[model samples]
Target: MQELAEVRLTAWVHGHVQGVGFRWWTRSRALELGLTGYAANKPDGRVEVVAQGPRAACEKLLELLQSGNTPGRVDNVVAEFSEPGDALSGFVER
Candidate 1:
C-alpha cells in the first residue's frame, strides 16, 4: 500500500484551557490517534498543540481539541495546516 502523506496541524485552543488539565487531555487524545506532537500552555491563557500525522488523524485531533475533555471550557480552536516537520517521535505534554 502506498504510504499516506504526513500533515501537520498547529492549533491554539482558547477558553479556560490553562488550568483544566487541557494539556494532559490533548496528549492522551493525540496518542490515541497515533499522532506525534506536543501540547503546552501559553502565557496568554491558551493551549497550543502541534500534531503531525496522517491528514485524517490530524483533522480528528483538531476536532478533539475543539471539544476538549478538560474541565475547562473550550471556547475556540484555531488551526493552521502546514507540511509536516517530521520532528516529533511521540506525543508529549510540553
Candidate 2:
C-alpha cells in the first residue's frame, strides 16, 4: 500500500477558546488521531494547535477544530499547511 504523505497543520482558533479546556480537548482529539504536536494558549485569547501526521489525519483534525463541537466557542479557525519539520512524540496541551 502506498503510504500517506506526512504533513503539518498549524491552526489559530479564535473566540472564547482559552480558560475553557480547549487545549485539553484538542490534545484528546490529536491523540485519537495518532497525531503528535501541541495545543497551546496564546496571549491574545486564542488557542494554537499544531498537529503533524498523515495528511488525511491532519485534515480531519482541522475539520474537527472548526466543527463547533469543541470545549469553547470557536468563532474562527485559521489554518496553515506545511511539510513536517520537527519530529514529535505524543500530543501535549500547554
- Per lDDT, the best of the predicted structures is 2
Candidate 2 residue-wise lDDT, 1-94, digit = tens: 2238999999999999998989999999999999999999999998999999998899999999999999879999999989998899899988
Q: Which stretches of candidate 2 lie over 4 Å from their true place?
A: 1-3
Q: Provide the lowest-lDDT 10-residue window in model 1.
A: 1-10
Instruction: Report the poorest 10 consecutive residues by lDDT, candidate 2.
Output: 1-10
Using TM-score, give the best candidate's number: 2
Q: For candidate 1, what's the RMSD?
A: 2.1
- C-alpha TM-score for every candidate: 0.90, 0.95
Task: Tell me the deviation in Å of residue 40 in model 1.
Answer: 0.7
lDDT of 1 by residue, 1-94 (tens): 2236788999998898887778888898889999999998888998899999888888888877766566589898889989988689898887
Task: TM-score for candidate 1, please give it.
Answer: 0.90
